[model samples]
Target: MAQQVRGVVARRKGEPVSIETVVVPDPGPGEAVVRVQACGVCHTDLHYREGGINDDFPFLLGHEAAGIVEEVGEGVEDVAPGDFVILNWRAVCGRCRACLRGRPWYCFDTHNARQKMTLTDGTELTPALGIGAFAEKTLVAAGQCTKVNPAVAPQVAGLLGCGVMAGLGAALNTADVRRGDSVAVIGVGGVGGAAVMGARLAAAATVVAVDVDDRKLAQAEKLGATHTVNSRTTDAVRAIRDLTGGFGADVVIEAVGRPETYEQAFYARDLAGTVVLVGVPTPEMELKLPLLDVFGRGGALKSSWYGDCLPSRDFPVLIDLHLQGRLDLGAFVSETIGLGDVEEAFATMRRGDVLRSVVLF
Candidate 1:
């Protein structure tokens, strides 16, 4: 028999989400049903509600989540019932070319559950990022549930599934920030702050944080930034160059996915230095940089997709680091709300009043 659970649903674009009774079917082949313990209020979830991602009406919102597996479908050996896990969107297909090549992080054909969760009227609900977890329970492919140290709290552990992981992976994996390298992160949101911490974790010679807001800059400093720059009232490129001994940062991370910030990231790095764009940009946005600059600066300009992370490998290690008192995963949780508080959480997130307003079950 199917289960009925309360969920936050976006019935239409730009309208408030509502708590509705969602019908969750029992797991089918390659699927698992999760009893969500905590889910973060990510900007992406807001994007989905605003019709920024797609026109998938009546979408099931929420992706950054952690929970206990209640049931597993046939052939699901990786995770079993009672296991605590963090949900991820990218469930790699083992036979994909990227996986066969040993770079499973770049798995070209990731997947989600085949069955759809629906409303009482039988209208299909599109799960946000293929892992709609804002509800009491969610369905996901088995591979999407990465088992981690269960001792960690659900709210903090869940964050590793999205934004924070993106930042850490951008600095530690994509840019490959090394000891003695100078790193500067632009935009001190949850992602940028994590990038700063990643640089510090890598023992970078200098970790500079650039943001338009002073409050965020202060938060970055607390998160291991060696220096801070208020880009709104200063020349970011010049300040970054000055901080880096008249050159620039060896790696510059653009966590604000806007054209102006991207341009700043381009010029704020040393010649031949890497620029990692971890920010999610809107489709209408475009960059118009001079061609010569791209040619003259001979390093890589890359975009990090989900922090170029492999959940099975990265999530456990990161959770361990948190458990060991290394990564301050708790700082990101500014407040905790209920499933009914999602609308207000969205408002708080829009005002930049909170780093992450988590929904606790």
Candidate 2:
């Protein structure tokens, strides 16, 4: 049966999102219907609203979510009705070359539900990141629902579905941050702060957080940063170098997608160190760097897509850590709001007023 649910929708670019009744179709083959309990208002959702992602209007706008499996389509085995799960956008196809090469995290062909959820008048709603969940109910591929312990709150568990997981994975998986390592994370937004938390989880010795906003820097300090650099007043690259014994951080994570921050991350790392780009960049932006420096630096320059996380392997583990109190996932939720408040959440997000304003269904 089809489900009618309230959701936040972006009808046009540069406009506020509206709460509307959306139609969530029944689970089709290889799909699952989720009863969303909570969804976070991520920067990516705002980007989608501003049409920074694409011109796909009438977009169903939330993706970072955790829910209970309400139903599963034919052949769905990993998850079933009544299961608590975090919905992920990347559902790896085992047959993809990346999966065949034993790297499912880089799966070339991740998938979502084949069917589309539509408006009452029959307009097809493009689900944001292919896992829209601002609604009370949403449909996704079975592979997208990763089962996790239900002891944790949905608001916290859902965070692993997107941005938080991406940040943590960038530090642990992409950058492979080792214990006692010196790390610097640029842009202390939700994602960057998570990288700080991840670095701490990985036992980094010195986690220096760099950002322009003092509020965000303060938040980063609680997350695990050994020092904070307000880039608006200080030279970020040089500050990181000074903090790291004048050689720069052993690993630098750039969570601000601007070219300036990118270059900062490029030069803020130690010789032969790692630089991880986890921030999303605008299409109009271009990055230029010295060719000589690129060779001289001599280390891996990597971009973490969803933190290069294999949801199936990482989500449950992170959730377990959260439940065990080893990770402070609850700290990420700045406040809880309803679907109608998405526009306000976007404003707060832009102003760096909150780490995340989650929508509670």
Candidate 3:
């Protein structure tokens, strides 16, 4: 039977989200219903609420989530009931060309549940990032459920689903940060802080954090940044170069999507070093760079999508690292709130008051 659950909903652009009754269908073929235990409040959710993503109104908010698989439909063999899982937006279709070439992480065709979750009035809701997880229970494609160790708390586990993963993967996966590499992360927010942590985990010799906010720079230091730069007061590129013995970082990860920060990242890396962009930018934003500089700097400029992560391959290993005390996933959860506090959480996020305000079911 279909179930009715309370979920966070953005009814219109620039309006605060409201709690509404969402009709969650039972799992259908290739789908699964997960009972969400915790969901993180992300900036992207705010974007959806503000209609920054599209004209899709009445979006079901919240995507970074962890849960238990309560039921799995026929033909869904990847996950079963009672499994602890992290819900992900990318459920790779095995037949896609990316998958055929064995790089499923770049799978061009990712999917969600075939059925639409709707309002009690039967209006369909566009889920945030194809996974509407603010509700108590949500439906997703079976591949979206990545089972991990049940020992980790849902609040910490859910983070691996989105921002945290994006940051970590930006360094570890996309940048391929290696031991002895010098990494500088710009915009030390949740994602930037995670990149700092990733660089440390990879045993980077120096991790310099650059941010306009002093509090975030402090937080980044706690996440293993060897040095912090208040980019607002200092020339970020010059400061980073000075810190790296006047050579610049071996890798620079830009977690702020603004063009200025991106330009700073371009100049803050050593020759032939990589610059990874993990930040979310506005659609109308444009970046102009010198063509000569692009040619002069013989390095890779890459955009990291979801940290280039493969949910099935990345989630469990990351969870295990956290369980072993090698990774500090819990440091990212600044506060926990109930479902009703999502609107307030959005305000908190905007003010940079917290790294993450999670909604616990």
Model 2 lDDT tens row, 1-361: 8989888889999987888889988898899999999999998888889888899789999999999999999999999999999999999999989999999999999998999998899999999999889999999999999999999999999998889998999999999999999999999889999999999999999999999999999999999999999999999999999999999889999998889999999999999999999998987899999999999989989999999999989988888888888999999999999878888888888888999999998
| Each prediction's whole-model lDDT (CA) | 0.94, 0.93, 0.95
Pitting candidate 2 against candidate 3, the one with the higher TM-score is: 3
What are the clash counts of all predictions, listed in order?
Answer: 0, 0, 0
Candidate 1 weakest ten by summed lDDT: 348-357
In the range 83-178, model 3's lDDT, one tens digit per residue, is 999999999999999999999999999999999999988999998998999999999899999999999999999998899999999999999999
In terms of lDDT, model 1 sits at 0.94
Report the Cα lDDT for residue 315, model 1: 97
Candidate 1 per-residue lDDT, tens place, 256-277, comes to 9999999999999999999999
How does each model score on TM-score? Answer: 0.99, 0.98, 0.99
**lDDT over C-alpha atoms for residue 279 of model 2:** 93
